[model samples]
Target: MPALKINVHFGGGAELLFDKIKKREVELPAVDKYLPECEKKGWTIRELLVWIKENLLRERPELFLQGESVRPGILVLINDTDWELYGELDYELQPSDTITFISTLHGG
Candidate 1:
């Protein structure tokens, strides 16, 4: 199987989520290997918002959500395009595809 590069960025306090995934507490794999991670994480494209809930808003109920209550500011991209635009996590990917996640903003 091809290796997938997962990137993550936290708008303000989202590094925690990234760290969790990096440490393997949040399991993910290459495109071909995605199903197992999704199943293990109890995730689906519709339920992808959990990544934000478990990592962000739950901690700060006072947080203001953007236009959509989503998985923080972390933008998940397959190669370059936003994963959300492609098909979210359900986006069909092949081996050798790269996945990146990044935050839109950060603290001063």
Candidate 2:
């Protein structure tokens, strides 16, 4: 059995969800095919967004906006690289892949 370890950075603490995969499974919804798998796994758009928001908020409260969604600012990095640059959420995952999500910071 293959297992995936996820460290969720949310609200004010880190949460972890470990899953055991026996067959084909998609962890993150990306590209086009991920939706079906994600839906099958109970991850809807709202849920996904909330998950990202909560997790990200935990790490950095300032990063999270009360009403605005976590798009264009929040960064999803996989293995120390931005997933959008590679393929966005559509990036595929293997057994030992580690995904990280964070908010971007800038200065003048």
The model with the greatest lDDT is 1
**Scored by CA lDDT, what does every candidate get?**
0.46, 0.42
All-Cα superposition RMSD per candidate: 7.0, 9.2
- Give the Cα-based TM-score of candidate 1 against the true structure: 0.39
Q: Predict model 2's lDDT versus the native.
A: 0.42
Tens digits of per-residue lDDT for model 2, 38-104 = 4343333334455455433344434444353444555655566766675654454544455554545
User: Which regions of candidate 2 fall more than 4 Å away from where they truly are?
Assistant: 1-3, 7-70, 105-108
- Over the stretch 1-108, how does candidate 1's per-residue lDDT look in tens digits? 444333333434444444434322233344235444444332343333444455433354323244344446556666677776877756544434554545565676
The candidate 2 region of ten consecutive residues with least summed lDDT is 11-20
Q: Which ten residues in a row have the lowest lDDT in candidate 1?
A: 22-31
Model 1 lDDT, residue 98, Cα: 55
Show the colliding residue pairs in model 2: 9-55, 10-54, 10-55, 10-58, 11-54, 11-58, 12-58, 30-89, 30-90, 31-90
